[model samples]
Structure formats: C-alpha cells, structure tokens
Target: MTCFPFLFGKKVSSDVRRDPEIDEGLSGIRIKVYTYKQLKIASDNFSPANKIGEGGFGSVFKGVLKDGKVAAIKVLSTESKQGVKEFLTEINVISEIQHENLVILYGCCVEGDHRILVYNYLENNSLAQTLLAGGHSNLYFDWQTRCRICIGVARGLAFLHEEVQPHIVHRDIKASNILLDKDLTPKISDFGLAKLIPSYMSHVSTRVAGTIGYLAPEYAIRGQLTRKADIYSFGVLLVEIVSGRTNTNTRLPMGDQYILERTWELYERKELVQLVDISLNGGFNAEEACKYLKIALLCTQDTPKHRPTMSSVVKMLTAEMDVNESKITKPGLISDVMDLKIREPKKKIGLETFPSSYNASSSSDSQGTTISLAASSAATTSTFTLKHDQSM
Candidate 1:
C-alpha cells in the first residue's frame, strides 16, 4: 500500500485505489481526492486550536478546505476497532441520505489506510455541547426551539425509516451525534453504525453495539435489530434534551439509574416537573413537556413492536393529533423476569451507564451481553425486577 500524509502532517498508509469499473455511488458531485499532506496544510496541521471533540471512532478537527471553506473533518484512526469497512460503509450510507435535518457530507478522502470525511461546519457544534456542557449557561433554548429540534430530528429519522428505498436504522442516536447550525436547528450526524434494512425484511439480527444507557432493552438483551431501535435511541436523546443531564451520571445518589428509569420513576410519581432542566426555571409549557415525556416513554418501550413508527412520532411532535382527546399510556419495560440474566466479569464500558473513568476497551462475547459497571455504593443499589409489561 502506498503511504499518504494526513492533515496532521503524519504519514499513513493509503488503501484507496482507483477502479474504473467500480461504482462511486456519488457520481454527479465532483469530489477532490486529497493527499494527507495537502489536507494537513489546509487544516494548519490539525492544530489543537481547531480541535472540536473525540469519539469512539476518532478525533474530529475543524479545518479549512483548499477551497477556503470551513469544515469539520473526522479523521479515522487506523488503530480504531471500526476499520476500513466501517469507514466505507459510513461514506456509502451518508452519501445517499439527504435531508434538511440531516448533516450534509461535503466529501471524503480515502487514500490508502488514511480515511477522512469532510462535513459542513455547523457553528453551534453539537446538541450535547450546547445543552449539557456548563460553559454555555447564557445560551437558553426556548420551548419552541426545543420542539422544533424534536420535530426536525423525528422527520429526519422518519425519512431514513420510510422514504429511503431500503430503510436505514441509525444504531447510534445520541445528543453528541445531533449537530446544530447557526440557527440552532438540529441535524443528525454520525452514520458509522447505521444499517440498511431490506424492503422485504421486518427486522435483522445483529450483535448489540451502541452507547450505554441508550440501547433499547430488547435490542440490548436479545440482539433483535429494527427501526424501532432507532426510536428507542431517539427517546433517550429526547429525555436528555428535556432534562439536561447525562444519561450515565455517577453523581446521582441512586446507583447508576439509567436516564430512562429515572424519568419513568419521576413520571409515575407525578413529579414530571422535576425532570425538566432546572435552567429553564419552569418557563417551559407544561402540556408540551408532558406530551414529549409520553412520546419518549412510548418510544423507549422495551418491545420493539410496541414502539410507534417514526411517522407516528413525527405526527405527535407536530401536534397533528388531537391533543385534547388523545389518551396516552406509559409503556412498561419488557423482559423475562425469571431470566434477569446479567453478563458477568463486569468491566466499565462506553458512555452507556458508566463514567468515562471506567475501562471501555474491554470486548464482549457474542451473546449480546454486558456486565453492569454501577459503583458499589449502597445508596445507589436498588433491587428491581424485570417484568413482561407491554406499552404502546
């Protein structure tokens, strides 16, 4: 393989080769293939001053393209477990998907082993940064803005699940993966874990992989993959937006209660007010909050079948349904109570239910199981039973 230099002025093996017969998928758009050195020069050698954030895949840098356009460049690390195949898959998936609520992929450079994807630079960064990070207290989003984001994200997912010839399931749908433009509009990003579902298939079986805390109970425990899996993730993201708390926080006294559990507990007790972000200072609409919470609970229902389709979710968000006459019920957690199986040799994993300090590099066996990484503090442990409850 011929070696290529990266935007960081580092040498890397180039695995990309030209094949006249190969389909580029993105045929009409002109794409300029850049050598690593050229990208590095354009990005000012990937300076820390331009660094945005890092993820399981690789570090993302803010860079200027050769055309003098600002962009966010995701440089895939060669050592990452997500390899060339995954990189190529992300490119193929994103290239075919286009929506106002979805991030746009400007281009990519796949020379040798060095891989980089360039995207339009959103001035507002990610939803996670704007909402959760403490640095931006003065930045308050009104209820209308929040509702727009929820609807926009739902429409984007609806497009993926319904409009696309082969439905797409975004395996990773977290706050960090949702970006914001200058107008504070939400745009879904990070298609690295997306899966294309055949038109004729109802579901696909696959290994369980996703951010902790956000995985649907059925998908996490049974490895049953479906578009509803994306709905479950969207539910988690919605709750995060409403509450402004990280899904997996060790700071809470209750032993590592996943955000869903916490929200459920609060909602059941009529303490829904407590779930809203304190920063909002009770300024948000009560009806809207309750409606969104109900929608979220419905989405996070343990059974994939019980969850509403993306189309329904979008309708609910837009208030197209008769709000006054609507009757919604809490979706109960679904799992075999007797089984209550827990994957043993518990080590810390990613952003799911554990803190970053916990080791995330451990690999899981093929049984679609993972050990709990909750802290041993007695105040946090609660004995709860998994019941086969159904919700719609």
Candidate 2:
C-alpha cells in the first residue's frame, strides 16, 4: 500500500516485543501466513504491470490466488533497511484490530530476509489518487459520497481512540493513508506508526514522526503527543476533503499557499462557501458544507485543549448535534516552522521559551518563539527544553 510510507521514519516505537502467542495463536484466527513462493506465484513473479501502488517502504502488486481471490500484495524493499521490529509492529497492531473502515490484513510473509504484507485489494485506491491528486482526473465524488467518507473515517478513528482495549493514537492521519473501496467507502490504512496510549496517561513526548504538512503544532514542536494531535491533523484532512487540495501549496503566492490560512481568511470574511472546491460546481449543500469547514477549524485550534474529542466530532458531522461556533478561536496557523531550534541543547540562565501548553493567539515579541505563524502561514517543526519564569 501507498500508505506504508509512515513506517520509513523515526515515529515507530522500538519497545513493542513480539508476543509468543502471535505465532501460537495463528491456528485459531482467520489470518494466514503464506510462504514467499506462494505470494510470488500469486503476483506473477511480481511483474511491473501488476504493480498497482507504491510508497517509501515498497510496492503493492495486484494478484490473483490459486483459489481465484484478488489481493493486494505489499513487498517491502530489501533496501528499506527496516528490520524485524517494524514487521512485528505492523502484524501485532493490525492483527488484533478489526473494523469496517479499517483496512483488512489478510496475512504476512516473513521468510528470512524477505518481509511482505497482504491486504484486501481496494478497487478505488486512495483519496490522494482519486480526490486530491492532479485535480480529480480519474474519479469525482458527489457530495453525498463525500459526507459518508468523512463520517466513516471519524467512526474508524473513534474506535481506535476509545473502543479498543488499550486506546491507540493513529499518529499519522492524512489523505494518502485513507484508501477508498469500490463503493467510495474510506478505510484507514497503515498502522506502522501507531502508539498505544494508556488510559491513565495524558501525553507522551517523543521525537516527532509524521508527514510534514498534516502534523499538529504541539506534537511537531514539543513532542507532546495526545489524541488531540490526531484531532488537529484530522482538522487539516477535513479541509482537504472540502477543498480538494493538500493543506500546503508551495506553488501559490505567499499569502494564499496554506489551506488553513485560506480557509480561516474566508471564514472571517463570511465567504467560507468560496473555499469549497469549484469543481463541485455548487452541487454540495452550502450551509452544511460551511458547518463541516467550521468544525475542521475548531479541531485545529491553536490550543490542544480546545479541539473536540473524536466522539463529539462524529455527532456534529452526523447532524446528531449542532456545532457551537461561539467557542471558536484563532487556530495556530503554522507556515514557516522550518526555522526551528531543537535537540542540541545549550546551557542558558533562563531561556525565554513559550509554554508547551499554549492557548493564546500570539505571544509577546520579547520571547523568541517557534509557534507563531508568519503572514504566509508556513509550517516547520521545533523543540526546546523550557524553564518557565513567572518573574517576567
């Protein structure tokens, strides 16, 4: 799957040990482990023509089994340099999880040096390809279908965040990771960077790992990852769904490049309707569409405390409840965050750093800060060791 790029970086936890039961329980569940040879034959020796998708870790080939079932075979590159740890994480997390909006993992092939993943073949590929890629050249989603897709993804995320035994935070929630089935139903793929968040703890700070654009500010900058980080990222994805473009656009003029900035600008001007993809051609409900956009903005508020829980988001999107716009505040719009100062700590008497728990829109100029968005709304990541001083 194209969604597998999530594993090619620093986000994955290294401490997840392989459960002895993982191999022993294989006989009880429906998961099958095919030999490398079997998959090779099914994939026609991994021919280029059968290749349906690709990403950072490897290529996905469409295959037909001897029993005549179609499948998607993901073969990890030998050069990927990933070891047994990544393979075990994917298997352990995905095998235990089952939900309709989550991709189905049929099995895996781990023979010697070869590491391969098997999943159901989705005919519609991903939202990135059909909805946001190259301006919708292949397929167009009508308004009703788009609504279903959004609600479907929310339900999936809510399951992972709440229903699972140990709550899981899907560290990476972006357009590409969302695969579409034949009926345009959205299934979230790629659990490579998933982290188990215990019910007792509120947050964990680790080295940031996620796509640059969809990253949440608190998570990206300070490594304070909570479920809110995922909420913030989902807010960005909602923008992409309504507008049919990536969150950041480097090609456009400086002022109009970032989608969040553009959306907020329109929201403030009462021109949020204009933010809808013109390609929709007035087919979507104006009032409902704007409500969706507003909800997305609310999720992306600068303060993590302000974002709604995934359960609340589902109710709002489904029309079970109304979005209270009175609490909406200016979100932390990040554009030029590339100029971060992190990791290589230097001793200082009292380094003036912004609080990790940021709520206000802007800080005083006296404090050198990384959280402030430039006029262009450019985003980059940074971190610091803080020593708060109330004396100032």
Highest lDDT model number: 2
CA error at residue 181 for candidate 1, angstroms: 1.1
Tell me the lDDT of model 1 at 22. 20
Clashes of 1: 11
lDDT of 1 by residue, 1-392 (tens): 11111212432233455322222422333345566776787678989777776544566778888788888877776676544556656666676457899888777776556677788888787666667654454567877788888899999999898888667898877776778888989888877667878779988877565555566766655566799889988988888788776665534565333567777777778776678877777889987887787788888776568778889898888888633323334544432332223332443323221111001111221111222322222222223233211110
* Candidate 2 per-residue lDDT over residues 230-325, each given as its tens digit: 898889899889888767665667677678888889899999999888888899999999999999999999999999999999999999989999
* Local accuracy by lDDT, each model: 0.64, 0.69
Model 2 residue runs over 4 Å out of place are 1-31, 337-392
